[model samples]
Target: MTINDIAARAGVSISAVSFALNGRKGVSDQTRARVLQVADEMGWAPSSAARSLAEAKTETFGLVLARDPHNLGVESFYMRFFAGLELEMSIRGYGLLLQVVPSVEAELAKLAKWRNSRSVDGIILVDLHVEDPRVALATQPGALPTVVVGDPSLAGGLTSVWTDDAESMRSAVRYLADLGHRRIARVAGLAALAHTSIRDAAFADETRALGIHGELVRTDYTPQQGAECTRAALTGAEPPTALIYDNDVMAMAGLTVAHELGLDVPGDLSMIAWDDSVLCEHTLPSLTALSHDVVAFGSHVARRLFAVVDGAEPGAFLDSTPSLRVRGSTGPLRG
Candidate 1:
């Protein structure tokens, strides 16, 4: 079906249908609604190529997932965060062009393709590394507007939306210290991620100040790696009295590993998770977590991206700080 059919069904001129469909100012609100209803009912879909040319817009945003899709597995935090971003995009009559790539170079190539093809109005970047080249790419003269979903330090001069991860890490350490956990081990995520660096530095600072013995083991945010690291830490000559994990899945795996060692959670060992999900509560003895609304964080990022697309000044914006949630998985260190 075509706009001609929609115009006929809505009892309006072809130009009127065009105005309504393109969100132009020529049509009244009632007429626009009638045109859209008639078009939807008639199964009239515009050609993407034709629509882009006519409206000078794709009405889409771009996002690249920088990792092997199979290796990444199911992550509740990202799923929820993506849903939140979709919510905002849908309300604004936009779509997200998602692509998963195997490496940082591949992700950058995807962004470049989108920019060159005019497939997106702007891009949202994730998993920033130290001295991220993406920041340099987007900050160059006449570069595409970008919103970085990481700490402001990684964004260079581009717009950024982030939580206070350093502060949050400090809080987690202090919470365990208060429970008399002197030797604490952290199950950290990929070292390349800018957040991991922030958290690692914070962990070091806090442990040093509080006179706590701390060990950090890095992983690819996989449950298997989480389990492996947990077992190694607990079976060491000098085991940690408490443990902190980068995410809920890893934390749950750590719990199981503790059991495999015939240890009691919050009795022989204490554990904390960085992100809260249903998994945290469902685990035996539950998991103490540093909690924040990830969905809301995604929404905040979307809003910032929209502002950038609208030619707003690029700057850093801090989202909600994560709060410590006490649970049965943590307790006073036993003698």
Candidate 2:
């Protein structure tokens, strides 16, 4: 409830508690962890009014999603990732300020306002673009501590945390190739996203190297678009034998589309999903998927932001890739 209570419970000096709670220097990491743990156990929260009067640290991190708000709430990966980010930030006595904007410029403007007003201590940037203006804005000298989520190449010198999407893409294509899937179609996420671009290029190169016909169908990360893509793919004169989707939502839609078309999953049509979620398991024919710990990825990104706030240098780091998880939805090419 109070700092005194936390100090007494933590068995540390009140000054130590103050330093740890304020994100200031002069406390050992162990001591800081102890103070925070005790504070959380004692149900202590810093008063916003009190924070304003002190050293000007808002103790908050900013995250902006330049996507449709409707989808973010329902998307399993983002939902889980957000939970992980909030968990870490809460343990560190920091709040998360999340916003959704429709345009890149608007997102940049919001970040600027937060910085100018000192409304947030740091920020997490996601979905790096091929020619991202946010990169330059975020990586400038004396800029706010930023952790960009995507490939390091897109970050323009800021701290970046990325998964090995290129390799993962290659692995997916290779897996299909091994299953005798010569004609493959990938239902990719937004075209402008750096990760999507990476996956596209890797998929093309890998397919070419393996002597397979690979096509990429772009979408806006919507189930409708996914269904449309699947319908088009299946109705083509030379339909692909195997299909890969960028997310579980789209993959499930694709599966439904296959069923609607009178196709047998893994018998006439093989399918794979990018992210492993509950949806992947609930389908009549469970989806084979490229899976990884998305929650852990979020925690890693959040910790990188904290490190940057603690004055660590900006650099790129790789998170774990999506490992292939074969399931009922994928099988050898069938005539």
Candidate 3:
């Protein structure tokens, strides 16, 4: 229904109805409440196009993933994260525009187009790189309000939401070392991502400090690559007594590779996975993992982007440090 009907039923002028409906100042609170109630009873709904035109806002946010879309189907982390984002955005009467591109260049192009076309009010950037061009683009004068989901250092002055991945990596390595694993290997994700680099350094430093022989193999965070890396590491001469995987899918794959090679869980090999999920709990041996509230982390990022959209200064927010959850998949290293 129209505001004219609401004004007539509420016994208020059309200007007063306009003020109350649009949250402008020219109406009393009691009158505004009455007008709103009457509008609701009359089945009044604001036209999205008109509202957007009046406010000069699209009321939408954007996110671009520069990775294989197939990986998102099996990766529980992104699913939970998206759920959290949707939760926050829906409550705020906002929409999310998501794009999955095969390369960083394509992702940048999409972001540029969104900004130029005014398709979204803000942006949430993920999978940050060490020398990310996106950071520069987001920092340009008159750029859209952007929040980076990565370490503060990688954000380049943009508002950022991050977990302590480096510290978590060190904790995982120390836990394995404490269990008498002198030879350890980590099946890492892509080498270019900023968090991956941070984790790699932490793994190397922690293992060296503990006098452990640490090996690292990089993959694309896919099950196929994970399986391949696992087979190669497990079949090498003097195989590691313990292994750490960057994500749960990789760890699960490694477990299968261990079984194929006649290795026993925590008996001949111990393992740890990052970003724990239901799959980790249901695995035959129940994987030990680095666990954090990924859904909450995503919600926190959305909140920061909203704050930035509301004219807040750029800053960093630390979500959490992933803690280790021990399970049947990891234990004292056996002889």
Candidate 4:
């Protein structure tokens, strides 16, 4: 219904009706309440387009993924994360504008376009790099409000929500060491991602400090790469007694590789996967994992972005450190 109808029924001036409807300062509280009640009675609803134009807000948030689209299907992390993000967005009657690009340059271009057009109220930045140019762009004057999902050090003054990847890596390494795994190997995700490097450093430091042999193999977070890495590590002259995978898909691939090689899980080689999921539990030998609430992590990032959009000072938030969950895939070393 039109504001004119509300003004006529409420016996108020059209301007008074406008002020009350928009919560502007011109109307008295009593008039505002009467106007609102009458409008509700008449089933009046604000036009989203008109409200957006009046407020200079699109009422939408943007997310850009610079990765292979195929990976999105198998990776449960992003699916769960999106579910959490949607949970927050739906409560506020907002929408998420998502775009997947092949490279960081394309992602940067898309962000610039969104900023120039005022198409989104804010943006969520993910998969942060060690020397991310996006951080510089995001910090520039007039850039869109941003919440980075990465280590604070890499966020470059933006509000950030990060998990303690380094500490989690150390904990996982120590867990395997305590189980008499003297030689261990890790199949890691992209080396360029900031979190991967942090985990790598922690893995190396913890393994050395404990006098354990540590090996690292880099992958693209794909099942194929995971299987290849697992095969190579297992075939080496001094194969590791324990292995860690960067993602559940990779860990599952490693399990298949172990089976192919006729190796008994937790008996011949111990294994642990990161980002625990339902797949981990249903495996032939249930997979041990470094588990955390990834969906909650996404929700926290959305909250931080909303805070930034509301003009709060940029800040860093630690979501949680992933804790080890022992299962059938890991055990004390037996030769």
Candidate 5:
């Protein structure tokens, strides 16, 4: 069925049907309902692309990430965060257009295309870096309404929601220090990610404050990389008495590597991780780390995006504090 069929059944012109279906203001309430009923009866649906052009609002948001779809399997944080975003967006009557691109330029192209074609009303960006171009583009005049989900050190005029990653990292390191772990090692995420840099700085600060020896190693946020880094840290001349990892996936890998090396968790090398996941609970010794409601983070960011789209004055960017979750993976340092 077509718009022409619905127009004929509703006793209105095709243009009137189009206006009603697109949520444009030219149609009366009665006419809009009649058109909708006829369209529903005929099993007809309006084209989103066409409706966006006619209504001047796409009612969609673009989500750009820099990872392959298959890599999502191990990243529990993103899956859970996205699920929360989808849930909130469903209630708010907005659709998400998610795209994965290899480079920042590719992501920029996708956003530009969406803007030029009127395919999205706004956008939400993840996986940010220092001095990211997306930050500048998002703040440009007439650019799509944007909400970013990483470091808040962005160009002025954009809305951002993030956790206090540096503070949380310091807290984790202090916990180990208070437990009398002098030799602590950090398994960091990608070197280029601003979050990783923040964490690294915080780790260094806390270790120095406590007068403890510290080491940090960078990885690609993959379990394999985490395992490899864990092995190297364990086999060092003076191995770390405690290990802190950037994410739960890498923490699990560290646990596996520790077991292969015949080291007892907590007893031989204590472990802590960021971003709590189900895998942490199932490990031989449950992992302890900084934890927060990532779902809430995603929803909070989405709500902020909606506020921006609704023309709210962009105020200070929001940051959530992370709490420590104690589990079996850490213990009193062996004397």
Candidate 6:
């Protein structure tokens, strides 16, 4: 039911019902209780849109992501990340307005709505690219308080929450290298993504530092493309003895390819995946992966955004560095 129904049931003015439903001041405590009781009895709820109009802030943080929302089901990283974000939001009595946009253009338009309409107090951005438009828009004074999830370069004047992909990548690579792996290759996600570039650079640097040859194959973040890239890598005359994947989905797909090629994992080739997920632990042979609290990572960004919403300094929160968690997906290289 709607607010009007609740007001009628409670024999109160629509404004009174509105204030009560929002836990806003103006109505007496007893009147608020009466309105709430009527709302509960009638199964009525106030509209977030209405609340946005009444109160300048929506009491929500907008999360703008460029990935397929449906992919969230299989990606365990998001599960933890969202939980952490929610944990912080819940404690602060704020809510999350999550939206999946098709492109950066659409995302910007959506953010504009939230800003002009005051539908959110602040925003958290994910999937940054080099010279992204979001960075440019966020630089404007008195724009929506923003926190970016990746790459400080694109963060511009906005607050950022980043992971130490360079150090973590070096550690993961060194883990395999120390295990005697050589001729390494990496399965990279969308080349345009900032994190992909970071991992690519780190992988190349670590390999060169260790004096081993390294190569990278870029693909969209999909299992099918991962399988195709895996086949190409495994079928080469001089195949790499180990592969480091940017995400667990691709690593699982690569593992399937390895089985098809009759190459025993770690016996013939080693594998290490970044951003540990449940798939890493459940996969046959269990992937050796660079693991970190990515969910906590996301939550940290959310809290920083909340701080900005509360009038904290802009661009005050900055980088995060992810640590390594070793598992079974990698092993010593064998000729």
TM-score of model 5 relative to the true fold? 0.83
Which residue window of length 10 is worst by lDDT in model 2?
48-57
- Please write out the lDDT profile of model 4 over residues 94-120, one tens digit for every residue: 788999999999999999998777688
Q: In model 6, which runs have C-alpha deviations exceeding 4 angstroms?
A: 1-56, 68-72, 315-320
Residue pair clashes in candidate 6? 81-295, 164-321, 164-322, 287-329, 288-329
Q: lDDT of model 5 at residue 35?
A: 85
Question: Estimated TM-score per prediction?
Answer: 0.85, 0.85, 0.85, 0.86, 0.83, 0.81
Q: Regarding TM-score, does 3 or 5 come out ahead?
A: 3
Q: Tell me how many residue pairs clash in candidate 1.
A: 0
The numbered model that scores best in lDDT is 4
List lDDT for all candidates, in order: 0.85, 0.85, 0.87, 0.88, 0.81, 0.78
Location of the lowest summed lDDT over 10 successive residues in candidate 4:
48-57
Superposition error at 24 for model 6 (Å):
5.1
Each candidate: how many clashes?
Answer: 0, 0, 0, 0, 0, 5
lDDT of 5: 0.81
Judged by TM-score relative to the true structure, which candidate is superior, 2 or 5? 2
Best by TM-score: 4
199 Cα displacement, candidate 1 (Å): 0.3
Candidate 2 lDDT, 1-335, residue by residue in tens = 34545666888765577788877898999999998898777766567325432423567888888988777755588778888888888887888888999888899999888766668878898888997988787766546679999998888888999999889889999988998999999999999888899999999999999999998999988888999999999999999999989999899999999999999999998999988997899897999999989988998999998887655778899999889898899998666
TM-score of model 4 (CA atoms): 0.86
Residue 131 lDDT in candidate 3: 78
